[model samples]
Target chain A: MLSAEHITVRYGRLTAVEDLSFRLREGEWLMLAGPNGAGKSSLIEAAARGVPCEGTFRWQGEDLRSLKPALLARRIGFLSQKNQVTYAYTVEEVVSLGRYAYRAGLFSGRDGDGGAAVERALEMTGLTALREASMLTLSGGETQRVFLAQVFAQEPRVLVLDEPANHLDLNYQKQIFSLIRRWLDQPGRAVLSVVHDLSLARRFGTHALLMDHGKGIARGPIDEVMTPELLRRVYGMDVHGWMRELLAPW
Target chain B: MTETRTLRRERFTPLTCLALTAALLLTMILCICVGSVRVSFSDTVTALWNGAFGLPIPEGIARNIILRVRLPRVLCVALCGAALSLCGAAMQGLLRNPLAEGSTLGVSSGAALGAILAVATGFTLPGFSFGGSMVLAMIFAFGSLVMILSLAWALDRSLETGSIILIGVIFTMFSSALISLIITFASDHTRTLSFWTMGSFSGVSYPHAGALGAALFLFGGVLLRFSPELNALSFGEDNARHIGVNVRRVKLILLITVSALIGVCVSIAGTVSFVGLIMPHIARMLVGPNHRRLLPASLFSGAIFLLLADLTARTLLSPIELPIGVVTSIVGAAAFVVIFYRTRKVRR
Candidate 1:
């Protein structure tokens, strides 16, 4: 289980996330829904241990900060929105970086029997055909799949994705979500995802957290917290009945 | 399955890298053998063996040339090449900019300024041969790096990578101007300053070779160990951090290490250019940007490239001895243009 308490994030003068507290257990899929500038990314970064924040983060009853970076990375995989590659590496090579912590000895190198894990990840993400393609040659949707495959190869217990489907097309969106669903089927693996599309969140998210200006306005099971009244209050719109159905047909 | 696809990519295997390394060693041997006074291959080998084992070989002209002169010169060239190339590779990886190298970052000019100042001041201490001068050069090289980094930080309101490179270019220009100003005022040391700036392998004794050789091995070992971290860094700082790399520590180590290597190179060889700038790129082309392979390959390729350049500098005009820096600059500038065009085309 991953638990965070009294999380406060500050960027110089501005307070991004103030006193935010939440708990995420194994097999739970929590969706963070917020408008722009609502500090969704900030919270994800803090939880991922990528930035400084005032809070206590624990995994399986152990303090997150106390764990070694490599050990923590093995348990928690964090994927940010932008995945820039300055040099051209093959898809397989990029994915193998997920196994960095597991690599042993000096000059153990990347081209070894770690193929089982890498091949499985590629197969899961449907990137088996493009496994040898250079990352510079990949399209946007293909690159996203490659990153997803990389994270899967890491085999982290808690997967934190910040807008995984930000720039993907509809088909890619469906493909990525289905992959996440397969991941969720496994025991002891949890996902915390920031999503902009309410329909997708309503469809895939097991729990919902409504955030506005860095504060959680509502949090509970998906069906209970995504009420029209609360969403309207948070979004400042009359998102009731027909409007709600139109936004989230499922 | 994509098994066929993997076969088609033709990975740059370790064996290929080893073969390249062997080729470099052969070239170094050839360089030592075929200098102004061609001490035939067999004679060169015998002399080198005799010198190594301390067996009594006639102290003839051939033996002296092989043992005292050409051997030290070649060793110095090899060390400079390896050091500069390693620094270049590390700098490029740290900045995430392929254009970042010793020459581009003004490190060469900075070190030149330090060495030139030492020459003009006639700075000498009792019981030390060029030690004080080398110390001054290293300090100045370190100062130049600090200046470049701070200027980049202060000017980078958006913290763009390109701004840091631009800041380095500005520093390069400023350093060049200062070097020229120093040269203009240096009356007594004008010839020495000019020759030093041009760069050569002349008068390099065993002590000089030993110092540079030890530095190359020490710093090169550290750089080779950082391949995985460098691979992580190629994905950008945030991603590297997320992947459990201590990005700050890596950057710090890279900065200090590369600066020191550059300092050592300048102090020893007087600022040879382009081995650092171009060798890494060639290595990347050969083995991809995976530093695990690229770093070692670049080190060998650098040693070869500079040795050949130095050889040409020695033999092209025979006795006239073209400055090694001139030869490297010509070849390096040409390679840079070709690479720049190719990279731009790839980007487009």
Candidate 2:
């Protein structure tokens, strides 16, 4: 399980996330649902040590900050929303970069099971065919899958995703979520994702944490926290009704 | 799959290593033979063979020029070429920008200023002159790196690539203006100052060659070992960190290593601009972006490219001995334009 305590992110006069805290249990996919400027990404970035923030995150009773970066890497995998790659690295090579945590030294080659893990990740994400292809030639969805494969190859106990399907179509959204869902089926694994699409969060997440103006509106099982009353309170609109209306046209 | 990975990780076998050594040695001998005094290839080889074994000199050959002059200059040039190219590749990987190099980052110019100061001051003291100049150059190079990074951070927290290059241009201009001011104040130093603008290695000696060789292996080895970290970094710093690369630590170490490299090269051969920026691109074209391959490949090509450039600089004009930087700059400027255009096109 992964846990956070007194998490806060600030920028001078503005408080992005304030005194936020939550625990993500094993086998649970916790969707951090919020509208724009709701500090969802801030919290995730704070937990991943991507930005300056005040927080203490623990994985399986171990304070992640105290752990060496390489050791912590084996316990947590984070996929950023935007990746700027300037080189023409092949998909296979990019994914295999995940093996760095297991490196023996500065001059070491791939680890013992590095190849097998990369093969599985590539095959699992349906990137095996594109393994030899340059990342530049891949579509948006394919690129996301390549990054997802990289995180999977890391074989961490927890996954932290910041809008994994932000720019992708619904088909890709479903495919990527389904892949992560299938991955979560394995024991001793959990996931925490920051998502704006309430429907997708409700559809895939077993638990939900809703925020509004940097404060938690509701937290618990997905169905309870996603109730019409609380959804209206945070989103300031009838989210369920809007989703139903959109689905009616379908 | 394992087979494919192994094939990708293919390394130079002992046979290839030996072949490369022989080829490099032969090329050096050939380069030594080409000059105003035309020593035959056989004599060149014999002189080198005898020099290696500490044998007595023969009557027919100009062993003094062969052993004590052109050989050291050529060797120093080659060493500087390898070091500059290696530094270029490392800096490019560190910044994740192809345009980033000693010149573009202003590190070379800063180190150039340091070298000028050292030359002016060291004209007095003959012993440890290379050491003193290298030390000053390293300090100035690292100082310039810190200046650019801090300036970029002040201008934009994100530290975008375009802004960093802009800052580099500004820094280089400032350093040039400073050098010009120094030139005005000290007319006596104008000859050395102008000579630096168009880097020449005609004055290189055996000690200079040995110093450059030592720095090349020392700093270049650090870069070669960080191949995987550099590969992860070229993707993105956040991604590299998530993959346990210790991004900040690796970046600091790599930048310091690059500064030392540029410092030593600038001290020895002046600023050979494009070798660092273009050599890696050429190497990438030949061997993919895997830093393990690209680093070594760039070093080799850079050595060869500079050797030819030095040959052209000394011979094309004949006796005049144009500065080496002029040759590399013309080629580098063209490469820079092509690369800039290509990067923009790809983004669009």
Q: Evaluated with DockQ, which candidate comes out highest? A: 2
lDDT of candidate 2 at residue B169, scale 0 to 100: 92
Q: Going through the candidates in order, what is chain B's TM-score?
A: 0.88, 0.93
Residues B147-203, candidate 1: write the lDDT tens digits.
887787788653345676677678777876777787789866734554545677888
Best-performing candidate as measured by TM-score: 2
* Per-residue alpha-carbon lDDT of candidate 2 for residues A1-250, written as tens digits (9 for 90 to 100): 8998888899898999988889999999999998899999988888888878787888877878888888878889999889877888889889988878988776678788888999899999999999989988888899999999999999999999999989999899999999999999999999999998887898899999998888777889999999999989888999889989999978
lDDT tens string, model 1, A161-207?
99998898999899988899898899999999999888889999999
Question: Where is the poorest 10-residue window by lDDT in model 2 chain B?
Answer: B3-12
Scored by Cα lDDT, where does model 1 land?
0.81
DockQ of each: 0.51, 0.75
Model 1: CA > 4 A from native: A104-114, A239-250, B1-18, B58-61, B114-128, B157-161, B181-198, B344-348
Model 1 DockQ reads 0.51
lDDT of 2 by residue, B1-348 (tens): 793555456455567567656766666776788876788998888888899999987898999989988999989988988899999998888778888889888899899888777666653235775687788888899999989988987998766678888999999989888876777777675446655555789888988888888888899989998988889999878999898888889989998999998998888887788899999998888778889788988888888788888888878888788899999999999999999899888888
lDDT of candidates 1 onward, in order: 0.81, 0.86
